[model samples]
Target chain A: MNRYPEIADRLMGLDEAVSRFVKDGCQLAIGGFTITRNPMAVAYEIVRQRVKDIHLVCHSNGQALDVLVGAGCVRRLEIAYGGNGRYAPTCVRFKKAVQRSEIEFEDYSNYQMSLRFLAGALSIPFIPTKSGLGSDLMNYEGFPPDIRREKKVASKKYAKMQNPFSEQRDEVVLLPALTPDVTILHAQFVGDDGTVRMKGLTFADIEQAKAADAVIVTCEDIVPRSFIRTDPDQNSLPPFFVDAIVKVPYGAHPTACYGFYDYDPKHLNLYRKMAEDDALFREYLDEWVYGVSSWEDYLTKVGMEMILKIKANPVIGYAPGLDRK
Target chain B: MIQYSDNEMMALAAGRFIKDGDIVFAGTGVSILAATAAKRIFAPKAVIFFETGGIDPSLDEIPMAVADLRAMAGTSLNSGLIEAFSIVGHRKLHTVAFLGAAQIDRYGNLNTTCIGDYFKPRTRFSGSGGACDVATFASGVITFMQHEKRRFVEKLDYLTSVGWYKGGNSRKELGLRRGGALAVVTNLGVLRFHEETKEMYLAEYFPGVTIGKIVESTGFPIDTSMAVEADAPTPGELQILREEVDPQRLICQAVLAAPQK
Candidate 1:
């Protein structure tokens, strides 16, 4: 008898997972920060499946966010920051898309976005914070009034009211909670029983996963039950929270995964170059996304030598002295 | 005479502002360099953390981004974004954030969002990641900039992060209890806000940079009465910053120029 019968049933291929759960006009929350642990394999598969009109919600995303937006999979975006560190100060394709007014977009600070996810996770209607009190984030409503009536979109950008607890004129900004249709993340390990473990900084991944209706996790390694259970503290999420689990090694390639590898600077640099022009970006999609048969095939295109160079040291949790430039 | 880059000077100048027991919140680019320099050279006891929730990391290598794996390496504890923000505004802690922006106003309000209109920006930058949060919560903020007239604008295209708001007690009147812009560190000099008016005034011009050059470069009216010539970067400070803080010269590498007599 399979110890993890429920997880066994949920285990599916990346293509199957994307087709079944991700649909047109679904709200999405992607895990990871600027240069680490982005769910790239699923992002690529979404592109391959030509998933469209995704309303992406993010805090400070990088590789996967850029790829989805670049490949024209995203229709609406609510983001705090879109950057890839030193590689690209502002994500090239994201910058172009916003500058060209290709997608409906709104902005929030990282804390505000994180709080929104937290509020969603807690099943709250709205969350109050002092973060965007005096900035344009409070003034400008990026989404049009008509779009506000949509299912996932908030009714208003933000609402301000005086603090009820304080007799003095203490005011705060109230942000609407975000409950995305799905949240996807890449992790270092997922047990056969479906327990997930992510090393390094979790960013807002936990809150995002809890906030979503469905959660998809793609991981580098799927370990045995005994190993994952030995240290409960190390595990990130409970098995029941994860709706689908796909084991794809280097699932976050070109983005760092703590003890797994460093971000592939060479690839990121190439992407930066290719994403600069419209014609070249299409070629990048053809050669990289559409051209590849599978994740393994994609890795083969990335090659063995670069893999070895980017591999992280277990003790330090990153490839020290990697040629980041 | 020792020749130093502008980055080297800026890092040292900003690092000096940090003291022991302060919590330093660092952004990427020169801010990282300055934060590291502060810990290594100025304040060994100061704890360096990232917005991604890496508390007191060893920082064996310079992180290219706030979420770089290097930031998580050898950390005392590795948490996530919510926890990190908790520490930033913890009331008890004295958090000093270092940030860079595309444009800044006379009151130190920042624009990291977009140029032109918000709807169709001519130049779009990475929108305020955590700058707004830190600027609101941290005990103070030290901003980095390139001293150019266009960058030091009278009015920002968009204010992504609130500094002094409209100056004076405006930030306080806007409902922020504590934090405000502490100083502005640039390629040419250091600027501080007035105690009463809250307007930016030239506090220190670098050894070679003239007061007139600073005045010419600023887009808005600035007070020069309080301006004084800043001390040159010492050999010891330069050695530590170049050798230990950033051996890769990732952010510290800039065109070397001789200090004017």
Candidate 2:
């Protein structure tokens, strides 16, 4: 019944997938909105492998971006929303790095960045938008204007042109396409043929998959193509778009996966504290990163009880104790 | 008279501005509370749109962020950021917005990008997510922030989102299509913009609030000739807000600690 038997058995280990696709000085786009379903397991592997000078890209970034910045694995950031949620104070490392001129920063709003992905996915040169016309984010040199002129070029990607259709004085801004060298995404399920099914809030996942040169998918379960074909409405990304598939359960741990778990606030709080200081950050790396061999070992370090405690209560979509009733 | 917290009063003031069938573009936090209050009290047919691409969601609880899963699932339309801005936001007319600002000027210009300077900011916030787009496209925009001397500045340290730039005809010069920011709701009072000048002036003061406190708190001088005392929250509005809208009391918890004390 299926025609894609050649693409079967695409499942592989996390570290092996990271090593095979990611490299130094490569541009990497990560998919997730804030602290939900980010490819944190593969991100940790990138840190462990000492992949330096990598350019980071995401529309809505949170702990994962902060972790990579804290680990010194990033040299450039193409960002839109880089703030933490209400639970934490701020992303301290990202702020410090930007202030210290350690990282090249290019800023975009949520709409602007999404249009960039849409353009890339459509194979268009650029897309027209009315979002960033008057804001300072349109500068050709990028944010922190005097810091790194040569290294920051994303702001130069925009151009202003007259809207020919409008008789009135109107000008539309064009945002250039963004296609990264490699992209990483975490999902609830993926088929052996590399079809990705995200449970909730597919924020730029499909666009990034179609736009990137290579896409590495980390999923909780690798099911047969037949399972994915049953309820095809939830089938977000098709197999032709994905390059590799890695099966890693609890892949979005610390961050929540809808219908699977709730975010570990205590762990995020601990990370927020440790990420502020360099020595503590290194110690955190030792205890969490190099201290483990594989994803299974990482879960063991996190403890089974804690994992079970954060499991989703099917009725409310979060853990039971949070109901407060 | 019913006793109501300042956060509830602020929500009431914002909710009163919504019509029955208005389309509102809501941000996180206070905006959600205000819009929810509106839906329960008067504007039953009011449609709420989140920038995360959710249109008319069936919300059970306050979402943590605009991109929360609850914002997407079971919505009338579940699109992405592109459709939010391009197809629905920009193309449509008569859309309302609920905005937040770290600082605001007399012209209603907002600052959420940073403070001091763009290069070396004294304090930096997570830059505007969809605030700029909303400020640019929406027909009517309302800003909500804690009223304080530092926040009501004469000039913003950096203008992230434009309200009525330089007071008059500036938005038109920029080719933007919308009636700029119309009102700013604070814990102390309500401020409305002048029709021609576009300058914000004190329109009403909440219960137990004094005119002197508002005048001292504002960084710039304002017109108070048309000022009126605001009515206390009605029992029906308070009951719905407490029992159904914010039963968890997230907004109440924030405003209970200190309210013009």
Candidate 3:
């Protein structure tokens, strides 16, 4: 009888997971909306490992996307809007890149982009929606002629066709499926069998996970499968959907994870300031990403006091002393 | 009588457009303040759909971003972007929306896409996130923007969100559902679309602000014949704005109110 030795681990370190799944020029979708539950650890690892020419797909991007853009890791972006909310300055490097035409981008509305993921998840060729009617996005007019022509080669991203079911509307827009090579998500919990249980808004997590060739989940903790099964309704992704599970306690630090911690707005403000200067942004990567060997070391630099300060309070759901600032 | 900054007045004026029981697609900046004030004061049961997919969140503090976890606090349904927008689109969710614009035309079409030629943009802004969807799908839309000649334009450099869509039944002809711009709330006055032509006109003027000033600030000719003095912020509205809606002056700050300052 052939016997397979007991597997040393289904769980791997952050670096090994990133090295294995993320490749240069891959179409990657990182889950979360703006500042909430972003896969920051994985994003930072991708940057530090010097992955290049990534085609990013996101709905509303914020700091994590900006950091990669600042690091010159991204070559193309398919997004709706990218900004650090009002309290922080605009993502300076991203703006500069757009102005310089260093990165080619295609803009879609949030719902339109979400629909693309839904189409990918449902294994459909395309899905129709009225979101982009009369907007320049439907024609890809904002892009330079060459880029626009290149973007149109896919054809299905925005194909205008008559609505067969509707007599009132003559035409509708269809978005192509966006099946990324890999999708990374940061969640609140993952069961032993890799059933993902996400708290707060599950913004595109399940869809992106199911729409990817490989799904990597970085979670706060690995809990018992029985614990997840007890509340089966809350499980967002089943075991078969996840390719890898990484336990990173403060994975979404700086960004907030619902029910776990509050965002460090001050840190984000500091990052916004750093992003304004190209030299300072590189220095930030050095001190924050390369200067630290691992996630534990990064946490050490972030300090337990600051972490505890932003820790979520039970009743209010954000850090107790946060808004007072 | 309490004094109010133009920013606070804008939020208060925008809030006036929200009816009780209307589900508002609330985003960041002044819209959050306006929607929160409306929910707290006029429309207590109104649902707010944050772009984060939180519906009717019970926030302890005013959310800075639509996706902020503060939006998830006490939310009835913490869904995703697809579910929320599809709900609005398919369910006829009886929604209202708040939007901001870099440039707007007489037809109320908004431009947040670019400042110059589309390919060679002079100044590029963050493109429409959910504004286009909400504007197309909502039952009524109210926009908040500073009153500046550059912002109130004769023609947008590029159209990002369609309001009345070249006036008349064109919006409906374009397959838009039964919602379009109802008001444009600026510091100086309130502008509304013409029922027939869909052209914007000065619907109401605020205290100490003249129709001439509004006309001077706008790039296109505006009708002022039927304009009236807008209802001032009530004592209750002002108190809620100052004390509860924005105690930190986050939305009531001078930079937004006094742009030249």
List TM-scores of chain B, every candidate: 0.96, 0.94, 0.94
Q: How high is the DockQ of candidate 3?
A: 0.54
True contacts kept of each: 0.85, 0.35, 0.65
TM-score of 1: 0.98
Work out the iRMS of candidate 2: 4.9
How would you encode candidate 3's per-residue C-alpha lDDT over A1-325 as one tens digit per residue? 3121121254788888888999888888988877778899998999889999888887876777887888888998888877656644245677778877888777888888888888889999788888888877776643345644443124435788888986765778888888889999999998876778998899888889888999889999888767989999888988888877888998987888888898887778778778778789888889988788989999999998888888987666677447523
Error of 2 at A306 (Å): 4.0
At residue B72, candidate 2 shows an lDDT of 59
Q: Show the lowest summed lDDT stretch of 10 residues, model 1 chain B.
A: B252-261
Q: For residues A1-325, write the lDDT of model 1, one tens digit per residue.
A: 7656758888889998898899999999999998899999999999999999999999999999999999999999999998887888889899999999999999999999999999999999999999998999888899999999999999998899999999999999999999999999999999988999999999999999999999999999889899999999999999999988998998998899999999999999999999999999999999999999989899999999999999999888999999887
Residue B119 of model 3, lDDT score: 60
Tell me which residue pairs clash in candidate 1: none
lDDT of 2 by residue, A162-181 (tens): 89898878988888888888
Candidate 2, which segments miss by more than 4 Å at Cα? A1-9, A143-157, A277-279, A314-325, B1-3, B87-93, B255-261
Alpha-carbon shift of residue A180 in model 2 (angstroms): 1.0
In terms of docking quality, model 2 is: acceptable
Error of 1 at A314 (Å): 0.7
Which candidate should be chosen as best, given lDDT against the real structure?
A: 1
